[model samples]
Target: MIEQLGPPTLFFTLSSANTKWPDLHKLFPKTQSNTVHHNRMQFIENLVNNPHITTLYLHLRFQIFRDEVIVKQLHATDHWYRYEWQHRGSAHIHGFLWLPQAPNIDNLDSSNHESIQSVKNLFDQYITTWNPRTEVDHLNKQYIPAISNPCLSNTGVISRSEPCTDYTELVNVVQCHMKCLEYTCLKKNSTLKCRYKAHWPEQHDSSLTLDHNNNPSYKPARNDSRLNVHNPMMLAIWRANVDCQAICSKKAILQYISKYVSKTEHKSESYIDILKRIVGLINSEDTILLAYHRFMMGIVADRDISTQETCHMLLKLPLISCTRQFVNLNVGKKIFQL
Candidate 1:
């Protein structure tokens, strides 16, 4: 596909927050006799017991996103995506989109300022790191009354006239996009460093520049360096954290994404040794049923399966989806035409 179509225009990740979604919370029955704390616990319990609900919700939301954003807004000519489960059992999608009109990084001339600026303009059109909190701060400096979360209402109604409605939605729902120090980012190297490089340098203006490796990199004008780049409208509609990045280096980005999408189940060295021993114990004289049982035991040992993942598989949901049909060509075989 890469040989035929070149690299994808954008590489993105969309994450799901099952607990944070009000729609998912509402799925549980409300009881007058239950206290607020009790109701919250019950709701969590329901989610744990019925993992399929959240899995299905994630699938449905992704479908809506594909139709509304990918097809309508971006007009992606080709795309591919895969779903993966997080440690906490939440589902997330990693995808690549090919936009026919997007500028090809491979063809970009770094020496030409006009060309670089044009590419930056196109990137800024779809992705941004602007936070609405800056606007609130500006208003407060001018002695305007402080605005609160617009979605927080007992009646569950937001006035369209409310000035902070959009701001509140972006800040509240996309909270996860904010970078913070965690185990995942903390690398245990000689000198500990953040794997995500969360401390992005503040840029006064958006610019398309070359990185240390001479790979084209687009840095959007950012007041809050901690906030990840995202599409504002898409973030609002999805009501979750999302990351959008330009494919600066075709080979690098493809290799990175391919590693993630093709990753196998993680197995420790000790587990591998055990599996090898189990295989060794199975002799040719052994019955097929006995050998199969031994092999299954070895494979199952130390394998962790989250409830959500189990539900995802049991429900027969697709883990991968692509817009274009692919055909396999055997380069090793000789073709003879009669």
Candidate 2:
């Protein structure tokens, strides 16, 4: 990845449950035929086999480009990304985008006060965890809060799973739902609070943190604890769990991304052979020399997509193909035209 794209400037994750990809939610919809979804293995197999998940992943790839142009207005020069069929019945993606113009310690000829300010402005303008203050934003569902994770109340009673009663109170006090969820875990572990120290009463304060790795990471301030870090346009489109963060230390991020890349996968012998050939090609002297030349010349990386037999089966299904139109909200909106 470093050979193709310089260092990454942004790292983000997109999940299937948080996506608007067509036919994803209907893969095992509660119908007469699919009522026996309690079979965990079958359910996961179905999720892994669903082509809509891949379609969503492809759409999200484009959406990232769209976001760079329309929202951030910055050039996303190059990116390296990967996907995973999560065990919890959804598709997960991790993308590392290298924006040459981003102002940070990673970039050369930058990291000055003005450059830091510019980066900070971009962070503030793009990354936020607050409810929509405008009517347009509300109508667009711009400030979608994550479902409050269950927690123990102040009275030593377990928090309710059904209709939330003290939701407002807990949110007002804890600042973040994750913080609330950690209360019992902390007690069980005999710890004072969350190890990350993120559970404290929320503070809307921006910090220029220089860690042990000498990486300057930016954290934008937000007054409200209920909001998750996300862009309005991003949430509006994906509407699922979305995380956008500035890349601090390139080495640190490289290590983090490597973990995902090295994840063990269930594959056929043919798939394994294909991977081995690709690795050989990548390690070849000619390929390495050519890539180095391209890297030196500042050429960018490209994208690739492929499907397996499972995905092909789903794609070829008549019932699945017939329901593609139901996957998009915009398509549903225009249904009155009929």
Candidate 3:
């Protein structure tokens, strides 16, 4: 995972959840435009145009309690998928929650240290939760490397599972699916049931038009019945956000560590801290890198239909993220149509 991004990649987006105030992007823009999400539409538009990125998925997993799926968040994307192991009192944590980590392993970069934060947010919005120790302990303690071991914190008995393979597989699979879906759509007559709920030139979501002939202008991945959304790769992406995958990864590592150490001291700092140092230290004029970051982040913001089932033709990942997030919001708008 580290190699793919070149360094301990930072989820600058994730850091906002830890803030006491609302996310910086949502609150302010010009001054704190450094937020990866600022001008999300511009970023996404650029992502589609980017030549490096191909396919991508932002997976999120939710905590199921009492038969209710407590969405950590819908994460704005349905193509994201997930996997699970028998609850081992630990959970794997991946922004990309593709798989689990190993014991005696210290992957500080991919730390799933949300020690029982909140699950309710998953039901409504994308939020992070943790059953934290005191602020000092939470802020001061170093996050242990995510090697397999015993459950470190008691957020839950479930342990984070180790990642079985690189999550780039998710991108690969999604790209494949999109390709197939696109083919089928061209050859066959199928659409999001042929319609657009997208707002007007001016109209409420319900007021939008429907194309009974499946002749709608654009097809959303979640609505495309031709493409299977429940595949393994997609599940990996969604799990990163909703499930305990990140938790599971840490759990495995904690368990592994327990086997070797009795009174091991939790480090005084964690990978999260290290990322902050780097992100904070970087100059604003690092324009090329920042541009790339914005490009990828826009892709991550991409979301699909609300329906769980989909069969739409597969779409290719933008080698370079150039599609603006705003396009996704207006996917059904006839304004883009001739």
Best candidate per TM-score, number?
1
Show the colliding residue pairs in model 1.
none
Ranking by lDDT: 1, 2, 3
lDDT of 2 at 232: 46
Model 1, position 215: C-alpha lDDT score: 82
Q: Let me know the TM-score candidate 3 reaches against the reference structure.
A: 0.18
Give the count of colliding residue pairs in each prediction. 0, 2, 124
Predicted candidate 2 versus true structure: per-residue lDDT over 158-219, tens digit per residue? 22322233332223222233443321234335555644445324555665566666667677
- Judging by lDDT against the true structure, name the best candidate: 1
lDDT preference between candidates 1 and 2, better one: 1
Q: For residues 1-338, could you state the per-residue lDDT of candidate 1 as single tens digits? A: 56678778778889876655655655555523322232445666767777788788788879988989888888888888988876435678988888877877778899988888888888888887665665556333222223333222222343344536554455544543344433246676787678778767767788887788878877888766566788776666676778888777786776876787697775433656766766666667878787666655555433466678888889999989898787888898779767
Model 3 lDDT on a 0 to 1 scale:
0.26
* Tens-digit per-residue lDDT, 224-264, candidate 3: 22222122323333322122222223334345336535733
Which pairs, if any, clash in model 2?
A: 18-240, 204-222
lDDT of 2 at 162: 27
lDDT value for candidate 2?
Answer: 0.47
